[model samples]
Target: MSRVRQILDMNAFDAATGGDGAVKRRLDNLGAASVLFYREPIEMVAARGAWMEARDGTRYLDFYNNVPSVGHSHPEVVAAISAQVARLNTNTRYLVEIVDDYLEALKAKLPVDLSNVVMTCSGSEANDLAIRVARAVSGRHGLIVTDTAYHGNTALVTEASPSALRRSPLPDHVVTVPAPGEAAYGGEDIAGGLRAAVVAAMQTLEARGHGIAAFLADSIFSSDGIFADPAGFLQPAVKTVQAAGGLYIADEVQPGFGRTGDAFWGYERHGLAPDIVTMGKPMGNGFPMAGMAARPEHLAMFCEDVGYFNTFGGNPVAAAAGRAVLRVIAAEGLQENARRVGAHLKAGLAQIAAGSDRVTAVRGAGLFLGVDLGAQDGSGAPDADYTVQVIDRMRDARVLIGAAGQFGATLKVRPPLCLSMAEAERFLEAFAGAVSD
Candidate 1:
């Protein structure tokens, strides 16, 4: 079996080997914390719509950044941010109309029962808050996550994110189940198998005296290689957890904001009404903002013990940016666009996979798709090295992409929601050439 790969290590630029003066300067500044893409990182200057311009003036079609879900430098978002900042930019303590307006607009898209929304600076903070609320509401310390899940980078979230851990074993309060897919659960009954795994994980947690507080998962399983098929596969497991007195936290940082096409949120695709829904980055269209939605009672319970406050979580500027993102997504009909263009893109990739042994599996919904690359020797083993080569080749072809999954062989295809059919075809063409070469 291939050794499981760490999330940040996948296709990361190694500063040790060295680079140009700019790269050296960056390493000197950020040191070991610097996470650059590609062995030869591109210095980007500007980006608009689906394409980014390097400092050298080369344009690359972006297919890996979900943070710019609506698009890169969307005029409305930029305008809104500028306009709001020019007028006023204050924290949540001030009763900013834009903040409330944005919250109302956001809540309109969420479950009605999740009445209270607490804004945060990032998904890490949102997830951290969700975990605390879950523990408070359920009175349990244990958490369950997928084997290769990556919730966020905060110490609390990092403890639960197995993919983020390079050396440390999962703490006793955390337990993991295999990702919901054929490779983990077999083809017979994925939903049932996953439910059983969660049940067993809950049992283990209970045995450890840390009864399950939450079953936190990225609804589409993005880092677990983008598993979106068997549509309601998560229902059984989520129900089992809830029945066992555990909250279900839908980490929508990756799959929220109509990226999944069929629904506004990925949890909706699985017919789930999550107890806690955490969203980030894409909510503000690259603006630094994130939020957690929960039942008022649950949030109140958590707050009673310790108050929650963020300096600039739902500030006026962030609210304006978020409002603009929501407006743009609705006005431009990006969700439908995602559904249509994503289907076309997926079909093109599936066609390529059908004809090529190296392209193993294609999965996911909407613009968020994952294509596994395998060895060419007919062994069908996941080839991380070949995946890196394909990524580099795609870069050479002026297309930006990245890798995911436990083996780091799954091409994570998540272009902006505003991706056009022409752009999709361009990516397909680049990808075909890259894999073939």
Candidate 2:
């Protein structure tokens, strides 16, 4: 650990949100980092449904983070996990019907060709495994990812991520292309922009004398301003990569499980089939369960060689959680809920943006929306002071929101799939009040 971390530990945040305001001399003496540099702080003690309680007993509506796809501490999901733990909780070596059922149900949500499953502990691990599968199946060594994108913090995925990350470096076999958004050459032709980026990736592979193992993308570009461009653009790119004997790996860590509303997987919107789809974050509704789906042939390669294994992946306990989440998602009709609520939220943001110079634009689909805070002030001169002020104001009004994209100007609103229309209305009302203030 760094000296800064050491200092933080020594100077433990004593108060709930450092409520006591007691600062340790050791921490005061050390250097600063993200934890120490937070501007809007919330001392959360508990959370349920769409609301979270702060240390001071204040209630904050959560309009950010899809990681808990279902509501927090959902009774059904919790019960499923508890029931499984009370029974059997073993590994892959065991003959387990639960594991098989979980994988099977999971397959039902993925592209038909990406049918086989490999469970992991997190999205980063799933992405890592997906890359490994691509490399092994294609006999290629190069990987391509979007610029300004974020896959995970794993060494390889981190390097493949965009420079927005703090400090990530990949090995020689990795290449990058800008995500199709305002920053890249897409100009609204996001799929075409991705295709162009794929061309550059192909060139990169040739230069390395290695075929591309995979072309990995977050279907709608969630980490890069939620860029879900015209649907069919990715097909040509996938074709090109397949021609080069590569696989398309969709990192569905964020937008999977009906986040996009129209489909279970965001890649579906692109009108292309991915050979591999890696999922995590919301799989177990916060239970640290993740997995990847690949065509059976690619899976055979791994089974043939070393034999894939994970101590905790798909353990009976994890399987139960996964099963419950899958059941709830379908039974509750959360996909349709996402569509209705997402549309309402986005429309509200667009309406609020009109006649207001503080917003550059609003874009996204389903339960995932991004509000581009214009740099221009009320007089049309550049001034992000409005955006900054709005975030602080929203926090004060007991709502949680986050920032995204390359410039950090867009306010991200990715609520749980179960968030109701009434909650959407509350969020919009708060946002409007913040803007007006």
Candidate 3:
């Protein structure tokens, strides 16, 4: 058998459990279960620019992970981390120039008013802190989020997450709105659905006689389909949230820092400024660092009374790594690369879709894109079964991407911002072959 197939076959067995079906059986025993139920695994051993080498040394183009934003093992980021660790890697309690220096550089990227910063160990913690600050400032207990959004797997976050929200039970104070599909969720009326979802949330709140804390959402709904219809989709929703006594929180874990091409933040493409912005994933370029950026006043309540202090939140090593990433993004013009390379890939995919029946259309902005397959009625959505088969075939073709959508039907194509047009063409060739097969 071929190497990829061999690895796929091995995925059914639990290496630790020592038997076929053992992993599934054990997971079933746990009683809490929710997975797309795909049966292939890519055992990654090494990573470089825009690719991952399997344990068997098989190469594959990477287009489904946003965590390694700049590129895997970027020399500058690695060097900065190494140099910092050689001197110091202490906690937030200590006064350090690296911490403040890193803050200054990061704050420079945003609008001047969005100055104050607080660090967290991960995106989930960043989100949690954002929520706390918003609640403290606004003095509201209720929260809001779009349906099918995936913030994190934390207790509070998951309750706000529509991706896995219905799978479990939690507080009713979270006002849920539909993600803009324009057909599936609320067909042909993107503006109406967005407005309706927010309006319905307000109605729900009034019925319960409650107020809202914050409207938390990804600037780009990564877990859902890549783009949620037209530009400025979330502007109406943000206005509704604020009017309903809530603050707007833009979750930048996936689409922040110019990955979305046209704007620095995915939400900016939608034409609204968030009150709070939570960042993670590429913030430290896989250094386990995340942070929240807010206006000075929102932080004032928490900074004095609650007092934010994290053990390793803004440590010297993590701060240095972050500084390096910001520098590289500007110096290397990666955000512009995302624009050029993503446009090339989008054009190629559209050209191919015109010629083939396999792919229906390409959706999303910049490197953050989705490939939807043709349906029987000429609709673009590839059913979950076909999406699984396509992703499986692509993996066999030595390309590594993943499935998104409520049922895992959308082929997620968010590669690192450093991906070049040559690599994009290479990916398109492999993808074409996979579809033809």
Candidate 4:
């Protein structure tokens, strides 16, 4: 199926929107490429911390959106953005204290060596810049990404994203490596598997005359079904890439900003220091702000050869928003909250899986959890159709969730970091009911 068609078909969309008018208008304007969530889509007008209020006044516990890391429409983030925008909004051509301050604060949270940053407007831009820099610095054109990984949505990045290329063949310069799934490993070394995959991919790329430029992967493997276990398993892969003269770029757009609870960045969980790190989505809460951090020495070659600059990147307003998100994360101790509430949520999911024959496995760390939905016949095979039903059912119960994995059979339950214990319980209750249904 096409990437856009994999989400919702026309009949389903028509039924969800209650008529053909909204669908027709969208198809007329946005064309057939627009993707929306849920069988019965909710028209959300407003949202707050961990909850979204629809146009009809229905409230839903949001467990899908990580963009609002701190919370939806957070007062502090709003105030910061408002204060900065009202005062001044301009390019990064001139010196700005807030921009430098934000960069310093972000650096403090990252690895000590990743001191240099190049800000962008989105994760796609960040990844694009990272890839460009890696290729320029390494003087190679080959890239390696996970089989079902999704980095972002740009011309260059789309080729790197296997999830977006579902039915299509990847480009010549790109190599797809298998993502490590728990079920795939039978007492095998996880790190070894990752290293082997990278080695094989690099060999293929070299044979194709596209020497390895970079091995880019989301540290959490979000689109490859959220494989975050066996901490430090990615260290071997990082070493393999670096030893082969390829840069290891950590796409932390999904796993950054303390969502993992254990560490600030997902790569930190695996005890691996990436050559370059890209962050977005939750960086400035809802604001459009993202950036790529790298070792100054590694990025210096690219800067000297093909000097880079962005117009709206790291502006005062975005800096203010980013600073607010960092402040809120530290002040509210949301990382601790994710650790506690994520554990509670995972335990509750385990309890539900214990009761249901259809639930095959529960995986992931912190606020990012994936529930494997199995066939109804007790065969334990991935059941994408059944997973879709459960997602729609959860939506009916006013809980927002999503699916991931190659077959889209894993329930992607990554709620906001601020999810409370009560909210986690509520989600568990709803999820248990959905599984039974």
Indicate which candidate wins on lDDT.
1
Candidate 3 local lDDT, 1-437, one digit each (tens): 11111111211223333223534554566534423223644556889888888777998888867888999989999999999999998998889999999999988877677899898879998998898898898787777776566787678777777665543554778777766765444546676677777777877866776677788888677776676448887788788878767899999988998898888778878888788889998998889999999999879977777778889899999999899999999998998898889889988888887877768767888889888764545555456656667777777877777766555566788999999888998989888877773
lDDT of 2 by residue, 292-324 (tens): 888888899967877678898888888888899
lDDT of every predicted structure (CA atoms): 0.94, 0.77, 0.77, 0.87
Order of quality (lDDT): 1, 4, 3, 2
Candidate 4 error regions (>4 Å) = 1-23
Backbone clashes in model 4, listed as residue pairs: none
Name every residue pair that clashes in candidate 3.
Answer: 142-213, 182-187, 182-188, 183-187
1-437 per-residue lDDT for model 1 (tens digits): 67789999998999889777889999999988999998888999999999999999999999989999999999999999999999999888888899999999999999999989999999999999999999999999999999999999999999999999999999999999999989889988999999999999999999999999999999989898999988999999999999989999999999999998999999999999899999997999999999999999999999999989999999999999999999999999999999999999999999998888899999999999999999888677899999999999999999999999999999999999999999999999998998774
Model 3 misplaced regions, further than 4 Å: 1-38, 184-189, 374-382
What is the Cα-based lDDT of residue 319 in candidate 3?
Answer: 96
Candidate number achieving the greatest TM-score relative to the actual structure: 1
Q: Which ten residues in a row have the lowest lDDT in candidate 3?
A: 1-10
Model 1's TM-score against the true structure: 0.99
